[model samples]
Target: MIEMTKRIRDLEVSEHLRTLTHERFGTRGRFTLLERASGIGASKWKNFYYKKQEATTEMIAFWIEKYPEDESFLMTGKIPPRKDGYPFGTIPPHVRQTETISDRLNWVIVEWTSPRGAALFEYLEERSKHQIAAEEWKKTVLGEQAPTAAMVEIVCKARPYFAAWITCGSEIDSYDQVDPTCTRSIKTWRSNLLKQLMSAPSEDPEK
Candidate 1:
């Protein structure tokens, strides 16, 4: 009976620690950040979270010292006093907003793949009157490297509709309004890339 009670208490404490950790580092928090902050290796942190091993006194002390404001809640699961209109250990709104933008940009560059991209490549080759091999185009769309400025300009001129979606993130209603400046053009391209990513179907066709 005593052993069972001890197991239950340990489980509760583990859960509380996990909750505190998650709250401190939003949903996207990584173990590497914890490793840096607490001086605990990722493997050990993972083991504690998975309940493969208990959190030692030294580890808990390190966490408390690192996040002194959270010590009360970390030890007793009690809510701490709010500071500057934000709760203790919660990520700030501006920081969360920045992370969201980064996530969208990363998704567009890394995760999103579409037939529209392939079509854009075909259009570029035909308009340039130069044969761009399939493998080369694949690398550009996958963001393995950036597409050349000449290629971007040619594509924008040849297929405004596709290029608008690819470069501006939405259909460019008026090409006349598009600034001819190099900086604006690059920004439009990146913005359109993110916009196109948002419109792409998320469900995996293979699944």
Candidate 2:
């Protein structure tokens, strides 16, 4: 049996993300509270954790709220939702005019006739552009694109924020996997695949 431990690693911190996270949650609780608020568990939390040089914006927001001086910061100012608008907006500009974040984050499946010849694709399609100068949004990969049908199945099992992009050159099927509560199928892969890198979550899938 696998032995689970309660030794939650204290989340990391950095200045750049610190400013961003504080701006995201409008709070000082950091990941400790952000995790609870987001309902994302430790396994999924790693995506926002760890870094030698820079802290993730999500982690920074979590840290500020968790710090002792949290109330002081809270009392002084309110952090606003990103200018792009989380939970209520669309990514600015666009390439795939017909696609949307809402479209990406739903249940979808695609079939490839020639398993050997086709590229069974899966991805998290986000739309993003810099707030300052960029006026258009672009599609970007969330995790690795599943290379084969079997890989697609494994990826589906992982419950990643992904969608099948192409069954073959003839067809491209895409959709998001809703409700990311169950990581049973892809838990191990998530650990191996996601390297605790920095992410902005600024891009909107529904652009």
**Top of the candidates by lDDT:** 1
Q: List candidate 1 stretches off by more than 4 Å.
A: 1-8, 27-29, 81-207
lDDT of 1 by residue, 121-148 (tens): 4544665676565445545543355566
lDDT (CA) for every model shown?
0.51, 0.31
Root-mean-square deviation (CA) per prediction: 15.5, 21.0
Q: Per-residue lDDT tens digits of candidate 2, residues 78-103?
A: 43333321221222112232144322
TM-score per candidate, chains pooled? 0.36, 0.18
Q: What does the lDDT come to for candidate 1?
A: 0.51
Runs of candidate 2 exceeding 4 Å displacement: 1-13, 28-31, 37-207
Task: Give the local distance difference test score of model 2.
Answer: 0.31
